[model samples]
Target: MKYPSTSTRSAIAALLCCTSLVPGQTAAQDAVQLPDIILDSGAVADDQTIVAEAISAGGKLTGDILDIPASVSVVTSAEIERRNAKDIEEVLNYTAGVVTNSYGADDRFDYFSIRGFNAYTYRDGLTLGENFGGIREEPFAFERVEVFKGANSAVFGVSDPGGSVNYVTKTPRGARFGSAYGTIGSFDTKEVGLDFGDVLNADGSLSYRFTGLVRDGEREYPFSRNDEVFVMGGLSWQPTERTELTFVLDHLDRDDVPGSGGFPIGYDFDRSDTFFGEPDFNFRGTERTTATLIGRHDFGNGLSFGGTARFSDGNDDFGYAYVSGQTATDANRSFFASDSAEKVAIADVHLAYDPQFGSFASSTLLGFEASRSESSNKRYFGPAPSVSIDDPVYTGAPSSVPLFADGETEVSGRAVYLQETLDWNDRVIASFGVRQDWIDITERDLLAGSSATNDISATTGRFGLTYKATTDLSLFASYAQSVVPAGTGVEPENGEQFEIGAKWRPLGGGTLLSAAAYDLSKTNITRTNPVTNLPEPIGEIRVRGIDLEAKAELGAFDLTASYSYIDPEITENGTAGNEGNQPARVPNHIGSIWANYTLEGDGARGDMTFGLGARYSGSYFFDDANVAGESDSYVAIDAAYTYALSDNTELAINATNLFDEKHVAFGGFYADFYSPGREVQATIRRSW
Candidate 1:
C-alpha cells in the first residue's frame, strides 16, 4: 500500500496506452477515466483546527465550501496559528465583507476594504504587488488565506470590484519535514521562524521546501521600529504521472518606522501616544523580489492542464514628518519624500474538463491571462518643522525633505475566460462565467513634462444557482459583473453584483451557517474638486449589504463569527456639498467573534487551549463633506493560550488590542486613525 506520489500511476498507464490510439474503439471504448485534478487539500494537519472542507479559491474551483456560489473565506494554517497572525491584515480579522487596518497603525502595507470597494493581494494565484505601490505580505509564508467576496473578475482577470485575496503558498510536501518557531512580545518583540521539507530523490520524484522569517519589532509609535526579513523557496517535480512542476522563490526585507501622520483635528483618544514626526524624521524602506512557476498536466477522458507564472519586484524608500494642521497648541508640518520602483508580471493558462453524461455532471474551464505593471516615483513635498501637540517635538532631519512630485506608471492587462459547472443529480447546481479584458495605461509627469496614454476594453459576467433541499440545506443565487480602468481618458468603471444565499450544516454536519443579501454597484466614480483637488467625471456608488457567517466544531469547542451591514451611498456627485455623502470610511456595523477551547488528555493533562475574541466597528465618515468629521464607534479584544509540550512541542500566547482600545481604527481625510496599542505575544513551536 505505498501511496502518495500524487498517485496517478503514470496517468493510468497513459490511459491504457490510449487504446491503440483510438482505432475502431476496440479496447473497451478506449478505456479512459480520470478526475481529481488536485486542487487544494493540503495544510490542515498540525492537529487540525477542523476545516471540514475547502479548495475552490483561485485554484480555479472544484467544489466544497458548499459548492461555491461566491463569498468565500478560508484562513487555515490552523487559522494562522490561532490568530497570532502578523500580517495580511491579521489574516482578515474575522472576515465577512472585510475591512482591516484600513490605514491605521500601518505595517508598510496591507490596508484593506472589501465589499465597499478596494481590495488586492494575491499570491499563489498571482499578482502580489501593486496596491498603491507597497505590497507586503508574509504571514509566515502562508499556507492558506483566501477571501473572495464580490466580483472576482469571473476568475481573476482584472480584479477589484470589492474582492480578491489569495496567498496560498507553502509548497513542496513530499515527506520528511521540520519546523521551528520562536517569538517574544510587547513592543520589543522578536521573532524567528523556519520550516523545511525534503525528499530529494530515491525516486520520490524530487521535492524541497523552505520558509524563513526573522522579525524585530516595536511600534506604539514614538521612534517606531520594525525590521523584517523573509525568504521562501520551493521546488517539486513529478516527472510523469501526468506531470507536475512547481518552483518558487521569494525574498522580502523591510525596515520600518511607518504609520506616518494621522491625528490632528482635536486629537482625541487621549492623545493616542502622539508623535508629531521626527524620530529622526520618520522612515520606511522595503525590497522585495519573487518568482513563481507552477504547472500540471493530466490527460484521460477528463482532461486537465494548468499553468501559473509570476514575477514581482519592489523597492521603496519613504520619509515623512507630517501633521499639516492643528492649533490650540501649535502643530502644522509637512515633509514627504519617496523613491519607488515596482514591477510585476503575471501569466496564467488553464484547461480543465470533467465529464459524465450518465447522470449529467460537468465541470469545464478555459483561461488565459497576462499582466504587466510598472511604477516609478521620486517625490518630495516640502514645508516642515512646527510642533507641539501638547509639548513640542524634534527638528527636521533626513536631509530635510526636498524633491517633490515626479511620477511614472504603466499598466497592461489581457484576459480571456470561460467557465462552466453543472451537476443535476446531487441536487442540481449550476454555474456559468465569461470574461474579456484589455487594458493599457502609461503615465508620466516626471516633473511636469507630461505624457499619458490609455486604452480600455471590458466584458465580464457570472451566473450561479444552487439548490439542495435537504441533507444539510443549501440555496443560492448570484450575478456578477465588473470592469475597472478609468482616468487617462475615461470610460471603464461599471460594476454590478446581486446575491442571495443561505447555507446550513446543522447537527449531523456539525455547525456552519451562512447568509447573504447584497446589491452592489459602481459607476464612473471620479469626483473630487473641493475647489481644485481636480479630477471630476461625476461619481456614483451604491452598496447595500448584509452578510453573516458562523463556523463551528463542537466536541472540544471552536467557533468563529462574522457580520456586516453596509449601505454606502454617493450616487452621483461632483461636489456640490458632496452629493449624498457617506463614503469616507464606510462602516455601518461590522462585527467579529471567535472562541476556542480544547483540553485533551494524553492520560494526564497534556494539551490545553483557550481563546476568545471580539471586534466591532460602526461609525463612519471623515470627509467628502459629510461634516463634523465622524469616526467613533469601536470595540476590540483578543486573547489566546495554548500548550502541548509533548509529541513535538508547542506553546502559544497571543493578544491583540485586548483592553487597550483607542477608538477610531481609521477615519482619515487628513488624520484620525488609531489602534496599535495592545499586543502581547509568546510562542515556541517545534515539529518533525
Candidate 2:
C-alpha cells in the first residue's frame, strides 16, 4: 500500500487549518494572511459598461467599442438571466453574424457558426478547443458572452477567421451575498441553482464563491433527453495592492440521453415527435473537469505582467442508431458506439506597458502561449435491422458488437506574439500585431498499426486604424490574417479579412450603434496529396458580409436590434462539381429585435416587466451540391414577463418560438434537422 508523502500531507493539513481560522482576524494578527481579492476575474465589470457600449472583445485591453475596428457584440448576464437561456446556443440565438442551432436541438455540443465559418470558443481569454478538452459550455456558468468578429489570430493565436466567442465566468466578490433559483419548464424540465459569495478575511482581501446547478429534462423529440449537473468554485486572493491571483474549478456531468439523430430527408412526419432509432441502447454520456489559475502583478513604471494556466480532462461515451444515406427511405439504418477520453493543458503569459512616447500614447503587449492535448477513442458497431417508417417495430436487431476502429491523437502548440496600439492626441488610433505559431501533431491508427507525425509553423498579422470623426463617432478600417491547421503534411488553411466600419454613441450615455462591412477569404484548402496520397491544401472559399447592431437603454425601455447579410461561396473545390456552390448551411440573412419595458406597479401589484422579441433567418442551401433541398426560412417569437415580489425576489416566465414555428434548422449528413418547437418556462428567484 502507498500513502501520500510527508510534504503532500503537510500541504493538505495547512489547507484544512485555514478553513478553521476566524473570519475576524487580520493578516497582521495571524501568521498567515488571507489576502485581498478582486472578483469579476480581471474583466471589466458589467457596471462599467454603458448599455453594452464598452467592450474588451477585440483585445484583452478594455476600451470603448468605437475604438475597435471589428464588429463586436456583448451579452451581459442580466440579459441572459432575463431570457432564461439554458445553453450557450440559446444565449447566442439573437446575436448578429451568428447562426445558432446549426445542428438543430442537439445537446452534445454548442455547435454554431459565425459569419460563414465556425467560431472558436474561449473562456477567460483562453481557447477551449481540443487544446483545452472541449466541452459543451453552459450559459449559466458565465457572466457574459462576447463575440469578436473577423480574424483575431494575431492576439489569440490559431483561430477561425470568422470570429471567436469569449465566455467570462462568474467570480468571487468582496461583498457577502447569495442567490438561489428554482425553475420548471416545458418538456418536463426542472432545475435548481445556487450562487453564494463571501469575503473570507477581515481585511477585505480574500473572497470565494460557490455556484452550482442540477437540471433534469427531456427533449421534445421521442426517446430523447437532456439532463446534466454542473458545479463551479472560485477563489480570489490579493496578497498585495499590486499582485493578485484567481483560481477556478469547474465540473460537469451529462448523464442522460445526449443527442438526437435527425430524420430522413422528405420524411413528411412531425420532426419533433418521431422516433426512428433504438430507445433502450441509444445514449450519450460525458463527464468533464477543468481547473484554471490566473495571476497578475503590476511592476509600476507603466509596466505589468500576468499569466493564465488551465488543465482539463473529460470522457465521453455515446451510442447512436442513425440513417446511413440521403436517398434511403427506411432501409439504411446503422448502429454504432464510441468511447473517448481526452486531456489537455494550456498556459500563457503576457507583459504590457502603457506609456507616452514623444507625441503618441501607446499600449504595447507581448505574450507567449502553449498547449498540449491527448485523446483516445474506441468504436464498435453491429448490423442493424431496418425498420418501417410508418409502422416502426421497437424490438429487433443484432446483439453482437464488433470492434470497428480505434485511434489516439496528440497535439501540441506554442505561439509568441506582440501587439502595439498608438493614439495621437486621443483623435487617431493605430494598432498592429503579429504572431507566429509552431504546431506538432501525432496520430496512431491502432487498428491499422500505423502512426504518423507532422510539425508545422505559421506567422500571422493584423493592422487597424480608427479615426475619431466626432466626439461620439468613429470610423475604422482593419486588415487581419490567420492560419488554421488542417492536418499533418496538409498545408494550413490561410485566411485574410479587410473590414471598414463606423460606430456611434447615439445617446451619449446609454446607447450604441455600429455598422460594418468585410470581405474575407480562405485558401490552401486541403485535398488529396498526389505524392503522399494524403490530404493537402489546394482549395479556396470566400465570404463577404455586412452587419448592423444597436443597443440602448431609454427611460423605461431596454432594446436591442441586429441585422446581418452574408454571402459565401466555394471558389475552389477538389470535387469539380462543388466549385461556385454556396457552402452548406450558410444562411444569407439574419435579423432580430428584442425590447423590454419596465413599469412600477401600484402598491399591491409590485413592479412588472414585459419583453417581446422576433428573430428571422433566411433560407439557404443545405448541401454542397445545392441539390438535395433547401432549409425553409422562418420567424421565431420570444416573450418574457417578470414581476418583482420584493426588492430581493422575483418571479418570471419566458417563452421562445411562441407561435410554434416548425421548420428545418439545418441539414445533416444523412437527414434534415428540424427546429425545436415552442418552449415556455417559469422561474422563481431570491437574493440576499
Candidate 3:
C-alpha cells in the first residue's frame, strides 16, 4: 500500500539499510526488513497525530508553528465551525491555558492572558499590533488560530508573558465558489460575511479568493454600539509542485457609537443606574489597512524555505468620560480625549533541513525577523458641562492638556533564532533551540521637555526530551526561557522559566491525557512614572502552576476537559516580600469542559450534533498592592447545535453564557466592568 510522504520514512529506511550490511552485524541484523506502513496502521488517521506531524515537518522545514518546542494548541477550521465562534476571543477561550478579558463598554478591546503570559497579536505569523490598543483585528479572515504557550522570544522577539496568537489567513484552495452567511442576535445585532474562491487560469496554477464581512451590533449593556467592516483578497500562484507564492490585501474600518464611559464597580448591576454619566463617550473609531506577501519553496531533498513581508497603517480617535460623586446630589463629571496614529512594517525568513545519520535523524530550522513601529498620541482633558439628570452637554473646547503634550513613541526590533530536533531509533527525541534579539525604544514627552532612547539585547533558550514508553504513551519534559524589553521609555528586564510534563494515551488512539508543572521567574523589571523620568524596580515575580488535560472520543460522543492551578507571587520587592503577594489578576484556579454528541448515521438526509461546555475561574485581586478587594468567582455555560441540510448547505445555532452569570473577568483599580450577557445567534451557510 502507498502511504503519504513523510520525512521519517526515508531516514529510517536508509538507516536500516546501512545497519543490515555492516560487517560486524549478525544474521538477524543483515536480513532485509520492510518499512513500517504508518498510514495502514491507523496511526496517521488521527487528527492529533496529523497535527503533530505537520508541526514537526514545519519545524524541520521552515520553523513556523512547528519549531517552537513549546506547548502549543491549534484550533482547526472544523472546530471553529463546530463552535460557531465569531471572534478571536471566542476561539481562544476554548484553548487550554488561555484567559481573555474585555473591559471597554462595547467589549471590542479584547485582552488575552495565556499561562500567565501576554502575546503580541500576529496575522499569518506577522505582528499586527497598533499604537492605541496594541491589537483589535477581527478573526473572520483566518483559516485557523494557533496559540503557543510559554515564553516565545524565539519567534516574537520582544513580547509579553502571555505567549503569542497567530491567525493563519484563509487562502484560495481547490474549490470553485462559496456562498454568504448572515447572523442576527440580541441587542439588534446583525452580521454578514461572504467567501469566494476560484481558479483563474485553465492550467489550475493561478487562483484567487475574496472574503469580506460587515457587522453592526449592540451589547446587552446600556448605550454601547459597534460597527465594523472588513475585506480581504488573496491571490495564489502554484506554478510547479516545488514552489508556491501568495499575496493578500486586507482592510478594516471600525466605529464605536457614543456611550456611557466605564461601568461603576458597585452599582453597575442596577439597570436603573444606566444614566450615571454622559452617553457620548466613544472608546475607539479607527481604520486599519494591511498587505502581506508570502512565498514557499521545497528542494525535494528534505530541505525547504519560506519568507513573509507585511505592512500596516492605522488611525484612531477615542474619548473617556466619567462621573465622580457619592450619590445623586454632589456628583461631578469629567471628559478626557485622545487621538492616535501609527505605522508598522515587518519581514521574516525561515529555512529548514532534514538529514540522516547512523541510527539517528535530525531536523533543523533557522529564522530571522525585523519590525519597526511608530506612533503618536495626543491627550485632551476638560470638564463636562452639567445639565439636567437626563441631559449632558460638552463644556470646553478640545486642546492639548498641560503637563502632557502630544506624547510620541517609536519602537523597533530585530531577532534571529535556530531550532533543531533529533530522533534516535524512533523512540527517543531531543529538541534544542535559542533566540537572540535587539530592541530600541524612543519616547518624547513634549510638555516635560524631555526625550529618551534606550537599546537592549538578550538571548533565550529551550531544551526538551521525549521518550516513547509505548506505542500509545509518551513521556516528555521541557524547559524554555523568554525575555521582553520594556516598552517605549522603559528599560528591559530578565525572565526565566522551568517546566516538566508527561503525556499518556491509555487507549492508544482513543484517549489522550497530559499533565505539566512549571515555575517561572522574572527580575530587574522596569517601572516608570508617567510624569517623571526616574525608573523604579518593579521587583521579582515568581509563578508556579500545574496543568491537566484530557481528550477522548467514545462511540458517538466526544469529550475534552482541562484544569489548572497557579500560585504566582512576588518573591522580592522594595515595598513588600514574597513575590508581590500573589500577582494581581492571576487567578489560582481555572477549568473548562466540553462535550459533543452526534445523531443520525445510516443513510440519512442530514445529521445533527449538539455540544455543551462550561468554564470556571477563581477569585482574583485587582491591584498590585493586593489591598483591593477580590473579584468573585464565576461559572459560565454554553451550548450549540448544527444540522446539515444537504451536501453543500448547513445551519447552526449557538448560545453563549446560557446562565447570564454576572461576573467580572478583569477590572481596573478605580472601576470594574461586567462581561457580556447571554447571547444567541443562528447562521446558514452554503458551499459549492
Best by TM-score: 2
Q: Which one wins by lDDT: 1 or 3?
A: 1
lDDT by residue (tens digit), candidate 3, 499-578: 76766656555566667777777777676655675776667777888878766667778777788887888777754443
What's model 1's TM-score?
Answer: 0.32
- Give the per-residue Cα lDDT of candidate 2 at 325: 53
Q: Please give, for residues 423-464, the per-residue lDDT of candidate 2 as tens digits.
A: 997789999999999999999989999998889899999999
Residues 1-688, model 1: lDDT tens digits: 1121232334334333432333332433432322212334542342255354565454576566676777777777777788787887777888888877655685667777887777766777765633544566777887777787787677776666677788778888766665566787876766667766667889878888877766666676667767676778899989877888999898887777667466676557343356777777688878888888888888878988898888888888888777777777777878887888888888888899988889888989998888898888888888887887777668858565667778888988888888999988767789988988888898888887988888888889889888878757778888888776765766777777888888787753547788888888887776556787545668777888988988787888889889999888877875455767777777878899888998887768678889988888787776656774777778788889888877566899999978887766655545566766788899987655
| Reference-based TM-score of each model | 0.32, 0.90, 0.85
Measured on C-alpha atoms, candidate 1 has an lDDT of 0.74
Model 2, residue 182: what's the lDDT? 79
List candidate 2 stretches off by more than 4 Å.
1-44, 47-50, 57-61, 130-134, 325-331, 357-359, 396-400, 527-533
